[model samples]
Target: MACDREVRRAVSGLSGADAKVYELIESMESAGIVAVPELCEAVKASTITFVGFSCTFGDDGERSIDIGRHGFFERKTRSRTENLLSKLRDLEKDVRFTVFIDDMEFRRVWGWSRSQESLTEECEFQIELAREESQIPGDWDVELWSRVESRIECIPKVCLNTELWHQINSGVACAPINYEMVLKWAAEPAQSRALDEIARMRQTYPRNRNVKLSELRASSVTGLAVYSHAGEVLEFLHPGAIFIHSADHRRDHMLGYRRTKPLPIIHPWR
Candidate 1:
């Protein structure tokens, strides 16, 4: 089973955190939510050239990503594109309302662990066909349930638990490997605002590459995140929100891969 083919390809070097960014692009592309322009915007650059799809015949986007999040990257049998497809499905399912997800922020919560399904899975797995809206959390609960393409067993704690979220985030600087720029940003008190600003900044001033995270300092217990074109990364900074990313979700940065409309795996986004 050769890789179906790469629908898209991207290269990055901003920081290792970008490994997550590349994965995001792969997910979006495989999921059919992203194109060259969209990917460039998401990853903070128009410079990204796409590599065609890497999947083979008969590999549906659903099939490519059919394996649960873990099956994408953890297992050696599935290729990376397939892993991306799997995560793409997860992303569309987990935080459907979440229009924008930072690469680093994505990893913070969903560092890729084997567990039960998500709390949201409740509505999806019910034996009864019709579920009462009152029993669900929000208005679009039913719609959310309907979109649960695949289900994985995740416990309520792992799904909704945000107990050590901040504490774990603050430790990002101390992680086995942290971004030097993020470390520098943690020192500035006024930098707290910058963290939120950082996510959006990359999209706009990607060419600047002058705003050093080390220059800004943050005192409040907030999360900061970034992405790079590197490979195989875990952990990311959260901007204004905490516990925003889904746990027991895609390790897109660290794991997750599946594909549907496989790309050509082109070298650059020509």
Candidate 2:
């Protein structure tokens, strides 16, 4: 079989070690062991991609059977390669290959002639379960599993009076209204005293409670009321603490009133 057009183009510019590597892959392509169109195109474009290839050398440094990795290619491709490698090893030839993605290499098969009894056994089992026609195992309930493992509840809304809301909106307290801003403020060493004050206030009024913003401003322990208010604002805006609306109308009224209904539960997997 002729090597694919893309495969030839992919190795057209290479020399030395890189050229040797692709030559081994081309042999596998010609043998109908694996199709390399996607892999070849990625190489030709110099884009990052994953592929596995191996070369075996004799004691006299003669190169022998070269093959691609299992799992990356289709079942038939893997099966053919495995069978070919097995037959080659039966003749006492060394067979080995390394799996790689771009510059990173992994799971190198060294001394394959002496490693194991069967090459395709474990691969076949895994491929069968991964096939589109295969049914999920009976022991697993996907729906219940999702509900238990993948759900995130909405945070309760906080209520603030008009004056306190204006104070925050006017930027007098430099309140953080988003998760990233909260993280930035929290990381500052200068904000430590304000964070301590906020922590003390949390002990008295849990985060989920509908507390007035005025309470945070008045409860300053370090006498820096502005910093205390800003720190409290960051706590409210922390991830998993509250959902901040992007719309102007909703954002305008965010601290004005408490929401009567709970926000919808999030299913991250979906």
Candidate 3:
């Protein structure tokens, strides 16, 4: 109830289309109201595990938006950490494996920094710490956090070896990373030319359609470099890391879409 009140207060301050949407969201919470088309599509669409990443680097080689800027962050971190917590809870229960992709603007919009932990890392630690300190009985908090964290298997756009990267790039017309899908996810559609450009690229380098999830291996990431909207990199000192890259480098390097199989092994850290 307290959280609801706070959310109401926040929504009340929104104006224009934002306000209307939030109003509907509030209705959804209070009366189970929802936009019919979207609800219907969501209900009808085949469920798949999808993970998204924007570029971490700007055109100027600086840091871009960080985990704090994500919609799931509610324009602030820690204060709205519950939003992410809840998302992970859902992801664990529903998703099996996720497909990761990066955008070209990743480098153009935000530069990379060697510092700062990725949002995923932040989420992992925060949940783990919260569980350890929780007063809840049966250590349910820990179970919840563990349940969500263990299932995650992250893959990078760039392969660990340049040979694999070349192998993928040589056969595909376009770089295989699905930038179009990422843009659509953000409610931003690319121009037709841009779409065609990728299509042509894909045509020139037609990809092998038979790759299997089990054939892929997860990359060993040392640290996740987080980009900040303020145009800087945020650094975190942690052992486990998740790395992401952009597809804009497709013309110069190999970037391919690869499926993932849920590993029988859990995250060793958890």
Candidate 4:
């Protein structure tokens, strides 16, 4: 498919680790969460732009990142973007870029794996019915969910386990060839603060209520998480669609790709 080829082309220069991160982000997007503007902006300003994504590395390395930090590079000229992307690609060959996913994100993906239908089912249920006051760990706001539910009410459920496995078995090149685990650690309970900020924004801002509401809900629903395989806490960041790796080395990064909508086929052949 031209689109699939284009998707591959967009991530051409990334290392296996970095590519997997992009794939995970795509999965989140497929599920209807907006792209992490910071990461997307960074990629756009760099040489490579993911026309779209569908797609890890594990090793010892030093990293400087935050658990929920967000930053973006200003748009650059084509030449500069290419140059920066080239440098990052070149550096990757020798330095080994790694994808450090958080346990929550790991669980999401893992839940898509065989033997976790129950977990995915539970997750889906929570996404659909859990309220702000619910004990569910990452429930979004009721008002936001109400709007989102209407938008995504009709999308079919995604069998992530089957689809992902099929892609892996078919030798899809959208993600890393190997699933490496650097460290298994816990994710911080920082979602509450994020939710609080969303509440404030919803109450204080009158413009673009639906858009803001959806985006705010999306932040809690399907943002990409950036983690460090070297086990370092990423710097602090504002409440947005971006996140840091983890709080300690025991866990490199935990990124949960959630959504109110159905997951899309990251790389379609047709």
Q: Please list the Cα RMSD from the true structure of every candidate, rounded to 1 decimal place.
A: 18.3, 26.6, 18.3, 20.8
- Assess the local accuracy of residue 254 in candidate 3 as a C-alpha lDDT between 0 and 100: 16
The runs of at least 3 residues in candidate 1 whose Cα sits more than 4 Å from the true structure, single-residue gaps closed, are 1-181, 195-223, 227-270
lDDT of 2 at 113: 44
Better TM-score candidate (2, 4): 4
Candidate achieving the largest TM-score: 3
lDDT of each: 0.27, 0.31, 0.27, 0.29
TM-score of 4: 0.19
Give per-residue CA lDDT, model 3, range 27-124, as digits (tens): 32322322222222222223312122322222243433332223222223223233322343353322222212123223322334433335344444
Tens-place lDDT digits, model 1, residues 137-207: 23111223112211211212133223332333442322232334334444356445544454344434454
Q: Provide TM-scores for the models.
A: 0.18, 0.18, 0.23, 0.19
The TM-score measured for candidate 1 stands at 0.18
The candidate maximizing lDDT is 2
Across residues 55-166, which tens digit of lDDT does each residue of candidate 2 receive? Answer: 2122323222212222223345444544544543454434442221110011121323422223233323433443433322222111211121112112212232334345
Q: What are the runs in model 4 whose C-alpha is more than 4 Å off? A: 1-85, 88-94, 100-114, 117-193, 198-270
Candidate 4 positional error at 174, Å: 39
Give the clashing pairs for model 2.
54-97
